[model samples]
Target chain A: MHGDQVTDKNLCLALINQLKWDAVCLTSKILECDDDRLRQDYINILNRTFAEQKQAFDFAKQHGWYQPMLAEQTMIGQVQSDTQKMVNEIQQSMMTMHQQAQYQAMPQQQNLNMGQGMGAFQHYAMPAMGHQQQIYGGSPQQYYR
Target chain B: MPHAKGKITARELLDLQSHLMLESNLVGQFNHFARECTDPQLRQMCESFARSRMDSFQRLAQHTNISPIQ
Candidate 1:
């Protein structure tokens, strides 16, 4: 059968369902058997059933109904590696941008430290304001100076 | 002459046989799914399931002294 014709998930499930029933029947038979030699015979039957199931799977894999597990794992590993690389790149870019921002702000911080009276005056010293406050504390007429 | 006693009890044998069958079925199902699934993630899931089933089967077989036919 063509690959496209056998790709149906339901069909595969149905096939597996049938196999499950067969396995259950074999299990029952194996459990009921008392003779050791006969038990081994039942075990053989079970193994044969399993082998047949495996063969069905092999056929499905050959027809491309499913992908090989190793190949799929390799694909997953590749995707994980790619995603990790992308995350690393993003982290690197973010770190670079942070560093650049810090570098650009350094000059401005130094400029502000040079007694530039701008924005909030927490760090800036108002020398003239200090003089006027001292004079006002002493006398109103001395406040003019 | 007296017959030699079996290494394991009948109940133990039944349990072992039942589990073996169950695990074998699971392994077969997962291996089938691993091979049949088109999606990479799904295929991986099936493959791991198959491996785990086989592992469980091996462990049980070892404890029960029942050699599984590979």
Candidate 2:
């Protein structure tokens, strides 16, 4: 495509960075900018430039041009993290179920004695048949640890 | 037309970069003095020239992808 016809996200961000850099340099060159009015005037131009970009973004929402490269990358990363978390939960649940099956296959009397292992099953909702959580702090204080 | 007869030597190529560095130095000197200058108009004018030179130097550095002389 011709350069004029190609509206790329990199080109857009590069243009914005250049414009913002120039605006900052111009503002720095101003001498009496300490005056509130002058400062506000200069700031307004900078703000308007970003505001223009925002309007462009909104207009291009249908074309997906409005989705910033940073935002897109972040969303992809979040999805990966969520998928990993789901996979981990699945694995943990499977392990727990397997251990219960193994225990159930053992002498039924041992399952009755399972209540003594407070460090283990209390973490899960089933609580391994009966000791209370108040003994281990139910507040999820050890939740992260 | 501008005259160009001989091929420029590698040394000359290096010298050209050196000259650009000197030009950048001149810009810094002018800026240093401009900051100390008491006359508002002259100081502003001098500083603006320095700024333009710095911009030029930065453009050249960016174009060549080389460090300007320290």
Candidate 3:
């Protein structure tokens, strides 16, 4: 295929590699277990898992999903770039979500500021001798005294 | 390299990679199993299993005309 053309098959294969790695890790952990009973139990589970995996592989083969590569290194490079693009898109979406959350929080912040303003008026403006005296119909100096 | 039956579909190519990847992983697991086993006979069995997996990996890689597992 062309260098820019990253087919679905390419992506699927790359992801399958991840599953292969998981199987490898599980097998290693199973082998490393010290208890004989536990190891045997793991082996039993692994056997069943392998059987399932084999079925899937067989299905792929039967459906013409497995084919040998003839000659094309461009596919590999295309897959790599496709993966990179996917990563970038994910990062961009995360950033957009973060910005959206911040935007959502701004209205609440403004409401908080409004509450604080009311608190300032109550504590400072109402308690001022000049203002209190004016309201009470007395001299500001007398009210201070 | 074994000649493919027809114009290989993208899906088939991907599946082939999956097969090779799994075989490579199975080899690694077998090697690990061999290392962890204390009994000589069990270790030998694990070692042989690993070898067989490697052989399978080589065959898969060969179909793709890629270098065998490192």
Q: lDDT by residue for model 2 over B16-53, one digit each (tens)?
A: 35534654664776576466545464356446546655
Model 2 chain B weakest 10-residue run by lDDT: B1-10
- DockQ, per model, reads 0.05, 0.02, 0.03
Candidate closer to the true structure by TM-score (higher is better), 2 or 3: 3
TM-score of chain A of each: 0.34, 0.30, 0.38
Kindly report the fnat of each predicted structure, to 2 decimals.
0.00, 0.00, 0.00
True contacts kept of 3: 0.00
What local lDDT does model 1 show for residue B3?
14
In model 3, the clashing pairs are A65-B12, A67-B12
Candidate 2 lDDT by residue in tens digits, A1-145: 4576423443334333444454454345233333343344335544544554354344345446455545578899999999999999999999999999988877755654574456565456355423444555464445436
Please give the clash total of every predicted structure, in order: 1, 0, 2
- The regions of model 2 sitting more than 4 angstroms off are A1-145, B1-12, B67-70
Best by TM-score: 1
DockQ, ranked from best to worst = 1, 3, 2
Tens digit of per-residue lDDT, candidate 3, span A14-133: 333433554564477465554444345445545644653454344345546666567568988898899999999999999999999999999976765454435455444345554454
In model 1, state the lDDT of residue B54. Answer: 76
Kindly list the per-residue Cα lDDT of model 3 for residues B1-70, writing each as its tens digit: 5335454455445555665567677678667656764546445645665675676566546555566657
Q: Arrange candidates by TM-score, highest first: which order?
A: 1, 3, 2
Worst 10 residues of 2 chain A by lDDT: A29-38
CA lDDT of each prediction against the hidden true structure: 0.63, 0.51, 0.57
